[model samples]
Target: MSAALLAALTATTPAAAAPPHWTIAPSAGGGSRPAAQDGRPYIYAEGAPGSVLEDKVAVTNPSAEPLTVAVRGAGAPDVRTKAKGPGAWLTFATRSVKIPARTRAEIPFTVTVPAGATPGDHPGAIVASGGGRTSGISVHLRVSGPTLSALTVEHVRVEGGDRIAYEVVNRGNTTLTPRLAVRADGLFGGVLDKGPRTLPVELPPGRRVRLTEPWHGAPALDAVDVKVTVTAGGGAGDSATATARFVPWGPLGGALAVLAGGAFAAYASVRRRRRKGPGPGTGNPRSAP
Candidate 1:
């Protein structure tokens, strides 16, 4: 029922060569921010679903002329889009403010997470609009909930030196620490059986990471099928398979040459024996005697 106050990390709107000393930062204290908060250039908050977190965004104008800034809240912007993601959840105290030259104005705001929000990170921002230019600080909100680990291994291929390459995708709504195991089978049986090896990764939801596994000593000549299996602590599991063929061309070629030479020698011996048989009445010695 009660809204708890959060001390914000601080950031200042970059001073342009033009005007409006507009600097935006989170309120650190009564009038001054603590040194710890000074290192934080952005606003970071943690809360559960349906919880309201309150903070302030300070706007300072040190320009010689009075500045009237229009405040607006926008969702966090992404590389593919600006003003995207859960920005509507933010509410500001005042929509607009007129600040005298060389003065700073602090605008209070509250961010309320929806009850149905997924347990993960949601980005947003508080913007001050003036002279067609808008600047603000980033807010990162982490919603706490049940942690689920889901992972998938894909696009598996064997590179040089028995190195296995594959991609891991996180399909669930939680961050996962994943480990990988590699197994390869040849015409006879298992050629490469690599035990489960822990990978250095913290995969977040909806992200795919490419990783590789080293199979130190692979069979020289074999038609092998390789599989990569990924698993995490919270029951996350997935596997992908691929095939590769390895041959020792030098050894194979030498074996073929030796067989050909032996066949030629046997054929010559048979022809010589047939030509000499009963050629010159050699077996009719009785008539000549």
Candidate 2:
């Protein structure tokens, strides 16, 4: 085979031929009665403001070789790049651990809720990275207080005459599953009306997502006012509107060409009249004398 063919095959091959076989999950209850509690799929905790909660995560290595893993919290706090949610509240005793083959290590962690933390579900995850692979176990932390769900629709507009774009913001302290409805009014009457439908997105508290809706049936020539309404559970809803104008340029261009041709002909007639130099019966004093 050619050298180029050999190089191509080498490039397509993966660096790691063996698949990683390790797992991370929430630890079962600790102490003498460790088997007294049932197995947990994820970590769950609830506390009042200014409280400290404890939990444990387990990492298991089934491979023949020892495995070293790095652990950290992700999600909520990383959403807006600020330390305000449960992701930032996590504090592990040790962030790294090593386990011998066929062994499991349980690590303890603490979640310290701030004094002014809001009340709602602050979903996060404890992630383990090892052996060129990673695993994450979810953490559902809720603060004890009244909860609220509110959202807003903003920046609604049409794009490329075929898509409607907008932004949805979760303004409350609770996660929201939003539904969207679209309506457009034109010069003559309503041009487009799409009923409410669930958006394939879950808006976490204090986060915004930009989404687009298909507008394949948009009019070719009309001035339209598009209104977008978004609503979520718990009486959270808001609406925004934008205006767009569409013109059938193909037909307009033909009419403009005809007008241009007529203007050019009128100009030619004026030029020819000027060149004829005052035809028949036109008065000239020197010629009359």
Candidate 3:
């Protein structure tokens, strides 16, 4: 074989494509630096209504090629469109930026809290998109004002014969971690007593979540009254009740049939005694009169 043909057959295969060499993070200590400080994963801000707060996000390009990134707000309260929440209150100094190879760009942004905004945590995120990939840093903005922790339990009911389902709503201005208690009273006595336990849910203001609790020990034959009580810190609490009936018609029907037969037999015995009247040991009531 020729040397040229042998060399062509030994060529290496093409390699897979590489991922983008860029990152986005919260600016270090609100400084002009492009890297984040340790233990500072998200941007935090606090202000009262009608106040303006500022923050920065850093986008770094470590590759040898220059990168252009498009920045915007995401998640709840985004300001990019007509929406409510902290995202809507944010405004960026520039929506697009170009960083040279091995450089970082720090973009500034402002959050303007409306005068009528409620007091509580309004979470949002700043996102940067480049090279078909995206990165984001969270923004935790808490408004200063009177905070209330209140909730409501609604639509309580039994589901699938083995679970209790209900809806919990946060009616206060602050977020709530609710604790739930379930109880059931039957015709005889208390049949279900589930003590209070912390629910794996985070209820934000004006949000309602539907959740279910396992009721594997539900009564097999009873008309039960179920109640769900939800409480959270900051004086938030509510209760709701529903009724469920679980009857085994197979057994109940047989019992009813036996009782009917016994009543008929007792009636026949009483009639026979009335017709026979007095015996030899006793006088007749009609003859004495």
Error of 1 at 117 (Å): 4.3
Which is better, 1 or 2, measured by TM-score? 2
lDDT of each: 0.72, 0.81, 0.79
Q: Runs in model 1 with CA error above 4 Å?
A: 1-52, 55-83, 86-140, 144-147, 187-191, 253-289
Give TM-scores for every candidate, taking all chains together and pairing residue i with residue i: 0.51, 0.82, 0.71
Model 3, 1-289: lDDT tens per residue?
1123223432333446564568887777472223443736777778998999888888889999889988877545422223487767779999999999999898999988888777776666666777666666766777898888888999998987899999998888776889999999999999999899998877667777899999987888999999999999998999999999998777998999999999999999999999998788787446565
Least well predicted 10-residue stretch by lDDT in candidate 2: 1-10
Quickly count the clashes in candidate 2: 0
Tens-digit lDDT track of model 1 for 1-289: 0011111222233565554546667766422233273545667767788888777777788878788887766653322223245567778788888888888888887877777677766556666678445666666667788766677888999998468899998877655778888889999999888788787876656667888887888899889999889998779999889999998888999999999999999999999999878666566456465
Tens-digit lDDT string for candidate 2 (1-289): 1122223322322345664488887888631123334577567788998999888888888988998988987654634336565667889989999889999999999988888777877777777777776667767677889989899888999999999999999888777889999999999999989999998887777888899999988999999999999999999999999999999899999999999999999999999999988977787656465
Angstrom error at residue 51, model 2 = 1.7
Residue 120 error, candidate 1, Å: 3.7
